[model samples]
Target: MHRGREAPICTRMSHPLVFDRALLRARQARALALGPEPFLLERATEDLSERLLTVKRRFETAVDLGTPTDLLSRALAGHPGIGTLMRAAPLAAGLAASERTIVADEEALPFANGSLDLVVSALALQMVNDLPGAFAQVRRALKPDGLFLAALIGGGSLAELREAFAIAESETTGGVSPRVAPFADVRDMGGLLQRAGFALPVTDVDRVVVRYGSPFTLMNELRRMGAGNVLAERRRVPLRRATLLRAAEIYAERFSDADGRVRATFEIVWLSGWVPHESQQKPLRPGSAKMRLADALGTTEKPAGETP
Candidate 1:
């Protein structure tokens, strides 16, 4: 909780120190080697594009930070409100087609202060080591009333896989090692948006369930998407074949449906907000409203500090 403003927001705070930037980059490059299946990226892009279409706010210039695939570039081009759009990738530098695609890090955004009308990130911020710093940078990069929209893997994602890995490791190696990266919950993420100074922030989780033949198949997809565990506390040694096989068994036994296909969860958390501006509506302070709840609701109401 925070105080002292019309809308409460936290100051500079803790970084997500668990993620490894170098490993994340390496995995991202590795994923690209499989030539872009892009199922998740496409879904994220569609959701983002749909949300943008509903908003009345017209952005003249926009930036897609930490673009995982080329889908974002096309998504931006379809929206008529944006005049220009830039794609910033993490691994590739200065790849130009029609729009400029420059390599950029999410932890350290390259945009000048108040330089953008809109900043959109997809499937990118989850790997950022300093998420607070990254959000703060996004807030700073926006002009007054500039909008920010992003979608990332959320806390509810991949629960079955994480549990199976832990149980298998504990049973096989007599120890538990981190096999999945933790994600922030939507409620907590809403606070983070405000912590980064976003006004009227909104956060929600969209849970997606996909069925696979086995956990190993799921792992292959995650690897191909460059979304595998890159946690600093992850096991340094390779996973034993016996342990991997056991984990697969556990996953199938626990998370599989009657049809024998195992379920995998991908909870996409969408965070939306805008820079503070005079034009936006704000909540009135306590006791400052012209009308009372009694009048509005047509009922007898007792004032606070009075017990009736």
Candidate 2:
């Protein structure tokens, strides 16, 4: 791996910090220690690996970025097309001593410019405060035509929990505090990729709905996944018992099914882009086509002022 000076952390944005990254890291470490459920990370790894299979090119150097578990790295291990797949975690606790792992922050990657052939992240990057800046750094770190593919928790995730909490808090305490981390929307992702100077950017969402016995069960799973509310503006006071009970009741009333199980939605937004290269496809310049649209379609041409 090509090592460079640690990239400066880009935390400030036009808006205030949306996440408490330090707290998030600590929670993630604790979750790991507690043997958090691996279902979500496993699903993301499978999807990302399948997506990589569709591309025929071999990557001489690649990275797994900050996935909480080693599932992604292990899945890619011994893949014929991948030469040296390194795993990077935000903290040391997430690293495996037996594997080629590095402690690197998503916001401040330590890679040299144009040094990587590919970068894949699964179920990470959503907590980043300066997401655009992180994307820009990833773009800068990739060789021309190198690919960046990631799956992160999207905005549609936990809609039920968010709504239930809001209504319950309002009804019980007269106000609602930030209880969930804000996620990235799929709609703005393409523009973010373009802004980061990546070419052929593609973004899509995979919505997964998991059913649980109750809202409390789902909340416990989230904490075990290290994805509990870590908002910088989150309420420091513990949630009132009345609010918690009310939220559970509201969740059951609104989101429960025939079997009396409640649903939790997780939207995994997949993003992919490439560093620009001349060999890649390019859009035709305006008025540069040899065949006119009318000729190609075998239809009569109509002027702007004339109706067809």
Q: How well does candidate 2 match the true structure in TM-score terms?
A: 0.95
Residue pairs in candidate 1 whose N, alpha carbon or C atoms collide under 3 angstroms: none
- Count of clashes, each model: 0, 0
Assess candidate 1 and give its TM-score to the true structure.
0.90
C-alpha TM-score for every candidate: 0.90, 0.95
Question: How do the residues 1-308 of candidate 1 rate in per-residue lDDT, one tens digit apiece?
Answer: 01222332335466547988788877877887776558878899999998998888789778888878777877778587787788877653223454366566887666767778999988888777778788988898788999999999898889999999899989999999888888878878888889889999998888899999888889999988888788998888988998999999999999999999999999999999999999999998888989977899998887688877
lDDT over C-alpha atoms for residue 38 of model 1 = 85
Candidate 2, residue 250: how far the Cα is off, in Å: 0.1
213-277, model 2: which lDDT tens digit per residue?
88989988898899888899999999999999999999999999999999999999999999999
Clash count, predicted structure 2:
0
Q: After superposition, how far is residue 100 of candidate 1 from its true place, in Å?
A: 1.8
